[model samples]
Target: MSSISIRKAVLSDLETLLELEQGVIKAERPLDPFLGKGELNYYNIPEMISNKNTHLLVAIVNNEVVASGYVRVENSKIYHKNVKHGYIGFMFVKENFRGQRISNLILDSLKNWAKENSLKELRLDVYSNNTGAIKAYERFGFTKSLVNMRTEI
Candidate 1:
């Protein structure tokens, strides 16, 4: 395994991040027609990187981004009990980079950043169908807390 360096993402990394996000959508949610499309504007690399409440981390191997993840801070009165809660999202690693422990490195960096910012707890929403992600999160001490449901109008 080559040395993997985790670092905070910068504006210069926007293009690479966009490609990685598209790759993840295609790989992880192939059945969804909107996977690689511009359906969810929030995933836009430039916007996400510039968002004050979001922290993006990238894992580089041989000076190339092999994995990435982010934590988005959601300010809401509903989370008053945990005033500084962060929502983890968009975790992805290139297919060839799997099994290299890159994900762990990226996650560790994100957690460290959260700690520095005085965050109390981290939360995320995973599709029930993504068992692999669920298992991975469990390994990092994340457990199922609540199940959310939605209906299309």
Candidate 2:
């Protein structure tokens, strides 16, 4: 059992982060085919890395990137217009690292980051077919706030 450490991602970690994003895209595309054809647009790696409202956490095992997740603050446009919520996304753990509680560690780090940013609530979206992730999020005190539906013409 190797030691796993979680920390804020830096510019020097961009290459590893992109690689991890590739892995994430590969796993998620099938769950949501319309997600595009190839690698995900992780928005802007540099901006995400430097943004104060966004926290990117990387999990390293023996100095190698094994998993990552991020949480960012977002404004509420309606019911909670006065507050900002924390949205968690880009969660992925290497295949070999599954079942080792790596996801929990990443989630915890993201939650702490949200708290530090003064977010009122934390939210995330999971594919309906991804049962494992859904269960994990539930265990972390997340509930199904809404359902997203799509139809193809």
Candidate 3:
């Protein structure tokens, strides 16, 4: 076991983050049939790092990035109780680092940032069939809220 540290992501971390992004997509492709085949990206690293509303974070062990996640302030729906909430995404932990609670540390930091910025709630989406991820999120205090359904016409 090695010491793990969490910090705000910087532009210099982009390359490693890109690799982690591929890890996330590869793990998810099997669970999501709607995802396009071939290379795809779910985030803009530079913009995310520069955006005041988003808090991107990375976990490092022995100076190597091993996990990553982010939370962004977003407007709640009109029917929702809160005015704004933190939308979490891009959660990934390298396969070698799995089950070590690195993701929990990232989530803690994101949750604290949301609290400091006055966000009342935090929300995220996970593939319903990704039970492993869902369990992890649930253990971190997230509850299942909504289920989205789709049909191909």
Candidate 4:
């Protein structure tokens, strides 16, 4: 841990973010093996970078990116009580950088971003089998909010 810093992600960081995303997808695929391998750019980075309602953050050590995450303001369906919420996603930290509080920095950054956007609640979807991530999220004060179940027909 040599002076880790969390900063807003910029368009110039596109390549680095994509590289980290590759590692994240590979690491998480086992949790959702049914999905197999596929591209996962559900939220466009460039668009998010330019969107005022989204905050993309990166953790860096000595100016080199070691981890990243983002929180975006989302609108719920008309039927939901919570109309607006912060959706955290695309979190990743390099293997060598684990246990260094990098995720905390990312989460703190997102918390501030969410508050600034006047969001009262935050939500994220995780693969049920990703116990490590579940524990990590729990350490950050997040608890199980919902569950989705399915089976092959």
TM-score of 3: 0.98
Model 2 residue 30 distance off true place after TM-score fit, in angstroms: 1.4
Model 2, range 1-153, lDDT digits (tens) per residue?
999999999999898888888887888878986786644675587899899888988999999989989998898767775578998998989898899999899999898878877776888889989999999999889998778999988
Tens-place lDDT per residue, model 4, 1-153, is: 499999999999999888988887888777775664568754578887888888999999988999999998999878878889999998999998999889988998899889887888888988888888889899998999779988877
Candidate 2 wrongly placed segments (more than 4 Å):
none
State each candidate's clash count. 0, 0, 0, 0
Each model's lDDT: 0.80, 0.87, 0.96, 0.87
The C-alpha local distance difference test score for the whole of candidate 1 amounts to 0.80
Better of 2 and 3 by lDDT: 3
- Candidate 3, residues 83-128: lDDT per residue as tens digits? 9999999999999999899999999999999999999999999999
Summed over model 1, clashes come to 0
Rank order (by TM-score, best first):
3, 2, 4, 1
- Model 3: lDDT equals 0.96
Clashes of 2: 0
How do the residues 22-136 of candidate 1 rate in per-residue lDDT, one tens digit apiece? 7766665653433445544348777778887789888888989878899887774674788568888879899888987677777788888888888878888887777887888
Which of the numbered candidates is closest to the native, going by highest TM-score? 3
| Model 1 alpha-carbon drift over 4 Å, by segment | 31-42, 151-153
What TM-score do all the candidates reach, one by one?
0.86, 0.93, 0.98, 0.91
